[model samples]
Target: MRQLSELDASFLYLESANAPMHIGSIYLFDASERETPLAFSTFVSYLRSRLHVVPVFRQRLKEIPLRMGHPYWIDDPDFSIERHLAYVSLGENSREASLMTLASKILEEPLKRDRPLWHITFVDGFQLGGDKEGNPGFALIVKLHHAAIDAFSGAEIMGKLLEYTPKPQPISAPRPWQPRPKPSEERVMLQAGANILRTPWRVTSIAAGAVEATARGLIQKQLRRIPLSFPLFTAPHSPFNRQITANRQIVSAKLDLSRLKAIKATLGDVTLNDVVLGLCAETLRRYLGDQNASNDESLVAMTPLSVRSSTLNRTTGNQMSAMLLDLATNEQNPAKRIRRIHWNAVASEPYREAIAADRLTELLPSAMLALSARLYSELQIAQRYQPVFNLPITNIPGPQVPLYLQGARLVQQYNAAPLFDSMGLVIVAVSYQGSLTLNFTMCPDVVAKGNSLRNHAYASLDAIEQAASMLDPEDMHTPLEETRSQSMADSAMNLLEGSLKKLTSRLRR
Candidate 1:
């Protein structure tokens, strides 16, 4: 049986009813045809075929005795799609708040471990009657354990399940499902013996790498001592930096990536990631400003970096390390904040080194990794360091073209990820079909204006887009000049007033 990685097992052990240890996506589909083109059963059949090659999709946990090894994937004999899928239609009086309430109820309960450790619910016959043209649509909510796949790999797997164009017919039926036969005791013993023999060399190599990494970290720290003096590098103390609740909140917004790309091109040398972080930083600035909250301190965000190589694309589990980014929201100008974020991104070398060390730790024996993980958990339980960051922010790239699921046209996609013990907010950005959708999931108590924060995120993008258009030589700064127009000023004032109202309502509530 293949064992769980230290990162993977930690997610399993830390799960609770309030905080389900799973990440999920919600897809809203709009179909042109009047008739229901894809029956729910047909979609299930397609999913079953996809699961044959992607075994993790169909298997559940097979926990082994002792933390000596990782959990095994056993074929779920009692698997039922009905238990996992749900069908729902919003009534005339339903509000977004009600939808959020329902979502919270769904998220509060942890996934059953005895089953395939994953589930997908199809919510059909949804009609928002807004800018969506009153089309009847459905929502697909998929939940998979953090142990199963990290964000990047998860996106890749999702792309595989979808098709750019509709297939004339569904693929042929999959072969009968089968469990992996258990190995003989003799073979198990021989493998254990071999592992024991190779343990010393692996252990030695790990030690050597740790020493080298430590030396490098020290040298880099010394070289960058001056710029690191800011609170940007130091950990902050807040209520969020404590043992976490087993609960989550997920909300999403979609923005045009091409517009963002235009901004980046005009900015020169700034990356797409920099623009994303900049937007978040600006949003936080406006959010706190509207709430009359303190703005002296910078916000720390834990940004996950994928260390996976091309060859390891299909591999599952976490191969990620995080860099604590100081969202220098104290800076008033958006462009300047963008530049500062870019520099801070460059200076976050030590965290990358720490992540590299983590990669080495994973190559050791399962027992060793488990012991180390337990010790790490104990340290967290004790609350050793001041919490290093405020929230976790991740960006996962998705397909550039529209994708279809069982013939329903996917309009928007959003992701919800876990918040660690010390973090209360997670902002995950998924780029699909030329738009960058930002999903903001946070503790309701911590984020007083959650919906406003979502709006501010989009507003920040609008501000950047305007600035970039102004800087463009060909565009003649027409859009930027228009910002000063009576109509534009009035619109901006209205938005600011609306946001203030929302913030006040949230705080009072």
Candidate 2:
């Protein structure tokens, strides 16, 4: 049995009934090429045979008596894979929209603490992808608690579960699992006491390191003259920045990856991520404008950045940090926002070393941190003050090549991440094959019309693309004019110019 790191246990403590701390994905796969249809029984047997590869699949969390220390991952004595699997047939209602709606509800429910913190559901009857209507496909929805695995590690587990080749590999013989006896209450208490004794030394070292890190970060920021957004400091409250309800709504939008890359190619000194952030900024600006909400101030986003490569000897748990970003949502021309975003990311990159997750986890006492998180949620402090960051945006990079599950080639992949109080919305982007899918998860009460927002994203990206095409390849770094005409007629003419250019290019092609 292994004790959960401070970073991992923090997720457990921070979770509330309204905010279930789990992350998951919806995958659409084509199984028509298989000799026989992929049956629920066959899939269950297939998953059961691979349990040895991921030991955490069968283990459940066991807390210490009176929560004296972090929880332990103990093998569930009564473990049964049957209890963790389910099958559903959508039949005629198996459209992608129906599937996403169902996924939202499943993702909101909390996982049972009595069992392993993961579950899977096999969905049949999804419509065929691309041409060939008769080509059969199915959807798979899987959820795992954030405490067990973050997005990066989840991808590692997926690499273990899926295959790189179309040819199915032979399943190995079942290896029996042995369950160790649960630790006695006395032993658990003693372990907690030992951990408590060691905290003083850890705190001392962590405190010293934190001060040094802060000073170093300040020096770098001043030397570079870069503006960075910090939690509760620069973020201004917005219409959606409030405590969220239990209910949630979800929507998925797909776009061509090549087009985003083309924008990056046309624009020098800007990363592809800058283009994605620009899309989000413009999309949200239009969304709020459509609702008649004020867009006077640019919205901020809390983007999660993985630090796995920088971290040393990190076998498991979360290895990430977040930085606040000014999305420049108020920019009149959505196409012009990428340059500002590029600058924002560049300025924020230097500050990452100061707030790395690994260092913070070492400094903070787990028990104290857990209590503080629980108290913060219960007291509703998030409602009283400015939010830490508006919402989380996770950009997950996926394999460009096709990945197969039991010989079924994956055609589409959508991601879903957890939400918390005062943070109603979260965006997850996954690029696979040649497409990038953006999944919007939000509380319906806080952010209405999730689909409407998604539709706006399409229009926003189109505007950006048209404007990008008009940019000159040489001297691409020329500043896009920041000032926009306030008159409606001038705005209309500007849009018309881009639209006509897009039409001409289409005709030329």
Candidate 3:
């Protein structure tokens, strides 16, 4: 059995009746072109064939005695794919709204811990009501515990489950499975004690590294003349920052990635991510404006920055750092707002969080860590403090080419990130094939304007594209950090020349 990382275990602690800490995606597939359409049984068979590819599906969590520490993942001897897979059939006239309602209901119930912390609900009888009048399709609502996979690994798992061609791929032979005996209570206690013994030194070293990284970051920021935005808890009080119920509202929209790229090119050096932040800013700006609320407060976003690389071990756990980006919602001009966001993105580095996450399992005692997290949620400490950030925005890049599941082409995909107690709303952006999909998950009571908000989000993207087109190419300036780097290079060259001349004079004398 392998121990769960602190980052992964925290999800378990943070979960509550009101807040379910699982991240999921809604996958839409068009099956009209297939000679024989797929059914629930077919989907289950395909998934079962691919189970060997992803071992996490067959693993279950085993908590230590008396909650001494984090949980461990062990192979379940009684693992059954049927237990994790369910089927849901909608009416022929079901629309997007109907599907969303079903999704919300499914998400309200937490995943059972006795089994693997994942489930997939296959939805059939969905018909695209637009120009393609009667073309039928299917939707797959995939629910996986955050402990199992983050955004990067989630996409990787999707690739493993899907294929580029309709032809069935030969399934590899499954290894004969054997379950190991559960660890004794004494063994668990001994391991927890060992971890306790090592934590102090580990934490001390990590603290020192974090301090050094922070100091270096501050110096670098000063050298570059970069102005940092407001600190955490600086976000103004808003309705979205209050406690929320368990009921969730889901909304989604698709935008053209080509258009986003064209807009990015027109906007000079700003990235596609900056454009996404700008779109969120405009969406909130308009949302507040419509409510007659104050829109002068600058909003901050808590974006997850993945730290995993090819060199790291491919484990089933969270490998990410935290980035707090300034959305600059107070800025009226979309161009300037995006520029500020770009500058912040350039100046910010995921130094401390990355270091902490790398050593989290070693530094923190799991029992105390879990206890603190549980207390934080149970007591609603999040509501007491000013919000650290206004909301979370995670944008994950997806495959550029279409993916197929048993010959059914995947048309669009939307992903939803978990929300905490106080933070009522979170935005997850994912790009698939040629389209970028925005998925918004929030407390329905807090954000009752779901439909209108989605429309505003769409319009905001258009506005950003328009603003990009109107930008004067010559007027755009490079970021201050880049300019400072160039200046420092020129100064170094001059200093080198002066030193060379001095040396030559000394030699001649």
Clash counts for all predictions: 5, 0, 0
- Give the TM-score ranking, best first: 3, 2, 1
Every candidate's lDDT: 0.64, 0.73, 0.73
Q: Which should have the higher lDDT, number 1 or number 3? A: 3
Encode model 3's per-residue lDDT on 1-509: one tens digit a residue: 78888789888877888888888788888888888768788788778777867888888998875555678898887898889989988977776667778988887778889999999999998785465476788899988999888877888888888999866565545556666676777787788667647543322323333354454556555634644342334556666887788888788878888887887777877888888878888988888788777877777677777878878656468888766566778778787678777876765443232223334333344544554455555545446555656788988999998899988888878787787877888899899888888888888877768667788888898888777777666646844433221222223334434654564354334
Please give, for residues 155-255, the per-residue lDDT of candidate 2 as tens digits.
77776788888887776666888888877778887887787576433233233334544544565456346443323333557667777877878787889
Q: Model 1, stretches more than 4 Å misplaced?
A: 74-84, 89-101, 128-133, 183-233, 238-243, 313-315, 347-354, 357-385, 466-509
Q: In candidate 2, which residue ranges exceed 4 Å CA deviation?
A: 129-134, 200-233, 310-315, 349-354, 358-364, 471-509
> Looking at candidate 1, what is the lDDT of residue 176?
81
Comparing candidate 2 with candidate 3, which one achieves the higher TM-score?
A: 3
**What is every candidate's alpha-carbon RMSD to the true fold?**
12.9, 13.1, 11.1
- Of candidate 1, the 10-residue stretch with the lowest lDDT total is 480-489
lDDT of 3: 0.73
- Please report, as a residue range, the 10-residue window in candidate 3 with the lowest summed lDDT: 481-490
TM, every model = 0.76, 0.83, 0.84
